[model samples]
Target: MTAVGAAAEIDTYMLAMPSPDSPVVLPQWISRGNTHPNSRYQDPIWSMAPLIDNPGTGLVKLHWKNCPGPLLDQVKLAAWTMINGQLRPTYLQTRGVQARSRSGGTDMLATCHEWMRLARWLHERQITSLAACAETEWRAYANERLSQVSRDTAAIICVRLANLWAFDQLSARPSGIARPPWEAEGVDDFLPAVGTAGGGENATEPLDPRVLGPLLIWAIRFIDDFADDILAAWAERRRMVAVAAAAKAAPAGWAALEEWLLPMARAGHPLPANSGKSEIQVATTYIAALTGSNRGQVSRFVKQYGLAEIAAERPGPCPLRVPVTGRINGEPWREHVDFNEAAELMKHLGTAATIILLYLTGMRPQEVQGLRSGCCPDPAPTADGTDGRRLIHSHHYKNVTDDDGNHISAGEVRQVPWVAITPVVHAIRVLERMVPEGELLLSTAHHEFHSRHGHAGALKKHTLTLRIESFVNWVNREAGVQGLSDQTIPEDPQGAIGLGRFRRSLAWHIARRPGGLIALAIQYGHMRTVLDARTSSSYGARGRGGIHAILDVETALAAADTAARLRDRVAAGENVSGPAARRALTAAAHTPRFEGRIVPRTFARKASTFLARDGIVLYDNPDAFLICAFKHDNALCEPEPGATAPRQYDCRPGCGNTVRTDTHAHQLRERADELDQFAAHAPGPVSKRLHANASRLRETADTHDATAHSAEALT
Candidate 1:
């Protein structure tokens, strides 16, 4: 049925859409039990408590606030036409277009907005509908649709509807609805952009200063109704997919311009003979502009981010014919790291987004090279019983208003929820304050991303090799050479941690929680079934491996047991391992007495499939995993007296096999990273000490290696 056909579902959302201008009276208690369908939303202190025990009807205060502008209003209206009015119609049109255009039945019809994002978009426009046809569902808008005026017409309808809605919300225009009785007296022209996409109803698009402004915003609001996601994904994984990331994403600037020019040369691309006047020489500059920033911002970001001049200019490491430098743990290996090489360890943090992605998600270098400004939300969605806008929605990945302010881009944007420890919330808030509306939310652009989808560009296309092996070597080079061999720079475990691990690992963590990924992962996947339908790929051939790696089940089990003994010892008034004097034992070596306990990566995958930037799954060597103690897994890494020391339990000695030292400590010298994922939630001081110890442990290991080197030289 057409969306117009499913009128009832539309009212399921819109009866509460609040055209109410003044206070409307209602009974003290709601008539029907109200179960807000969105599990993502948490009840705020000031908000109505959703009576979920029984679903029902209840009237909510309808004070409107934070409305959009005239043009924005028009755009909102247009958006409504397409999203609500033409929901089924557009799907039919788009479906026919897809079928007729190519027999291939391409996957391009998928919405750029994920389930929750689309839901949020709909809710904000006051077009809240529970109808399947009204959902931000798939409609193929290909080149065929692009050629058709209806496609643009649909987009135009979307923007107009959204603009008007935002304006009404801001009180710039009159609200079409009535107000509720319970609202306080001072609330006039009440407009709230609550639960809006981009976390607000402002609807500002990031555009380079060199370009036109307001009209551009209009173009964005009008044209970008739902096409950005499709376009961005197409750009990222398009004809470009076959190309390796190293080539597409290389930091190539001037030095390798000669070779990079070959692609254009092959196509006889345009370039002025004079590099200065020529766009080719300034391709990076253009990339910044087209991507909604000034040339300077893009140039500075690319340079500071240490991008290669061209793919070929990217640095490469010379693999050893032999272990020229030394060995780690008596194995044939590379250079040694000095752990006590320093006293009190200090770590300088980068921009919070970078640091968080580095510290929390464990994303890698090139993968993060092109963080499209603010694609990662400032405050992730929080579950502390508040409106869910604080949650980080994932649509930022597909399109973020490119240079012309009329284009799109794609990739996996962060979908992190805000049910985190306080510091993470603060860090998120800090980011919100710092970001400019049209600017990239990231500290610096790692490379020039001219496409609609920013980072989806392969690194190798710009010129270096793109394999994970190459990525490993590049990071290893810094650790092994400039930093390791010279000893000037201390070892950073985060260096070895790359993009491949985060989604799977996070999935594993989520899987172990009570309600499984649903309860643990927080926020949502639009609806229940969307998350549950992953068996095809998740446990399927290409996907199961990722679930295996997400959690180190072996580690968790071992860790759990260690905690129990420690607990029993405390209860019995006995010291663990016959503790005599002071403090409880460190839990770094908690051993789960039960063999069956495991971290639930499979369930995590089922829950967090939306998070995987690419469908590709990550796998870990089965031998590499072990059970974990909750505290030890989260942090509080130390040895339990009755349990084996983390060091003692190693493949040999001093190991947890994490990229960290304790995680990194026993394996301080290894390149695999074990950066702090738990620090965000830790009691501040203890977390600091733990990070310090990890850094220091690496330094000490470095020192010990240095001494051994000196001894060998004396011999």
Candidate 2:
């Protein structure tokens, strides 16, 4: 029937039939109770809460009440159809648009928003239905929308509108255009510039070094150093609460108060003062909780005995005596953690563990949230009698599909587990102590410290985001007290810290580091060979989220930056000499300028090609005081056969690829001078060895001065 004919009998045709007449039917793949479909399409709201297994996916309700009155039924019909995979053949026939399966909860919500936008636009123009709207009106809406949002975002809205044309026969209002939004042109025209058929570059910015370095330093410290104090304090808090609850049930009165105070008095231990304050103040409520007396009764007893004045004379009480093991600059980070702050500290500790996991494991935030207490078990032995590394098992939701390529709400277990490093394992162990085994490590239920307070479920992303910011603020606040002001994580120019940025930043660091695994080996205690052999390539390929693409972008950028720096140093009259110095100069001069440009996947492909040029690939090693013009054949650092990059961390002396500049000579002599100063303070035989090493360094400097020639003269 035509849309106009459908509108006449809309109530009879569109409204859901009685439950007995039309029993609830679900898609075969949708494991019955995983999603709830509203029987009546006339309902103001349709909740897909069960469909959202991951809280990180955000909201899942479609608010039909929010749409304009004229197109409400049309919007509902389109959304319902999309969720049920009921798209008409006409919509599937549209060029460059193909969606065969049911929409996921998150995608359904986005489609609803698109419908609302189109509905409001139509209503504002006094157009009641899609049948009356023409190509002219659609173009006007698209142009106005393109100005407000990005071309890609605008394209999504355009695609949604085009789908309506296919659903015209089903919708009572028939709100859609007959032709595509951009006539004779495809939706691909609005996408970001790319050279290949691959996806767009990752837009998530890696955390700036100024922010990431200190952030990680403090996060590791929280896991390694402060964890003991925090966990102990938490246990003490729980113990105290339990004792208080027992006393409340069986009121022991003033006799209990005397019994509690007498022991501390005999030991000459000060009363547990109000830990919330900076100065000592007898905690009457704390005393009452311990003694089972009212606060007034405890206050009366303290006044009669002059306990407040006596407490002033004695050192402040350390109720738990949880020693301050975490230090800064060779001293304890804090003298003591107070009982009042323990609950707050536990929350921050969870945030710290989260940061360590996200930054080190390269797991997405939701995957980290999905992690249970026993996610990482002890390392097992392989069949070959070798020790296997620890692995974390978790579920990934985004882009998770079944064998038929249809999106499924019930996320599957990752076939290849994430390899866990020491820091990640430490963080997991710390979290395991906080939450019960088999419970989510970051579950909101465990965060409250008290069983009655929080809702039981995965902690939401916005909540985690706030916790991250609070953790940063806590670090900065403690910096002054610890006298480590330089170690404070500065405010990111990219705005507040987030969990999403860690993966991108990790990929950047791993790909940009001198050796692919050198940074991981030092910071996380995992060898490069193990990660590469086990899961490195598959980790990037599994999701196809452009992690490998991101790595290539960073690698290319690093290479380009190194080449640019080399070119600048040569032009500034620095002398350069080595086996491949001339080749280095030539490549540096011709290297493409990529600074400040949006690096597309095409650039990534070109970057792979750029890195493949072996004999001339320049790897700057500041620690070694030289540049490596890496050649697979001549490399003494023992790169695997056919490897394009050099093992820069294992730079061997006398390698033909090593290039020494005027700066390297200066640094060598400077090092020799420092060693001479150390030699003067050493014992007899030790002093002689120091002097010999210093002399050797000076000789190397002299050799460089003799052989090095200016870049202008060499070319």
Top-lDDT candidate index: 2
lDDT of 2 by residue, 1-715 (tens): 7555555465422322123222222344256645444344555667665455664565457777778987776666666655543454444555443354445677767777876887888899898876666868776777676566655566666666665655444444344545654645766654444332222434567788788888887888888888998898888767766555555323466788678785786688866776334666676655666667767777777888888776767735535556778876678777888776788889899988998888877777878888888889997789998877788888776677665445766566776677777888999999999888898898787886534554546777888899899989999998876778888889989887777888878766664554433234364213322333323434423533334456556656777787888888877888887777887888788777665645543566776678778776677766567788878888897765555566666778788887877877899888889888998999989889989988887887787888888887878
TM-scores, one per candidate = 0.23, 0.82
After superposition, candidate 1 runs with Cα above 4 Å error:
1-359, 362-372, 375-446, 449-483, 486-498, 503-715
Candidate 2 CA-lDDT value: 0.69
List, residue by residue over 1-715, the lDDT tens digit for candidate 1: 6443364355322212222231121222222533332211111111222211111112122111222222233233222222222123222243322211111001111121122233344455565332321212212111222233333243333332233232233222233422221122321222222222221101112111112122112122212221222223323332222332223323443334434433433453442121233222333432332233344444564455433243223322211112223233343233321111100000111122333332233233333333333443544455784543233332222222333221222333333321222233333343343334534333322222222333322232122212222323333453464334422222223333233333333333332221222121222111111122334312111233322333333223323443454444444443211111111233322222343322232333442332231111111111222222222222223323221122111212222222111221235444223435455557989778667755664664564334321111222
Candidate 1 local Cα displacement, residue 115, angstroms: 29
Kindly report which residue stretches of model 2 are placed more than 4 angstroms away from their true locations once superposed.
Answer: 1-40, 86-100, 166-177, 188-201, 249-251, 258-285, 292-318, 321-332, 382-386, 450-457, 513-521, 524-546, 640-643, 663-701, 710-715
Cα lDDT, model 2, residue 402: 62
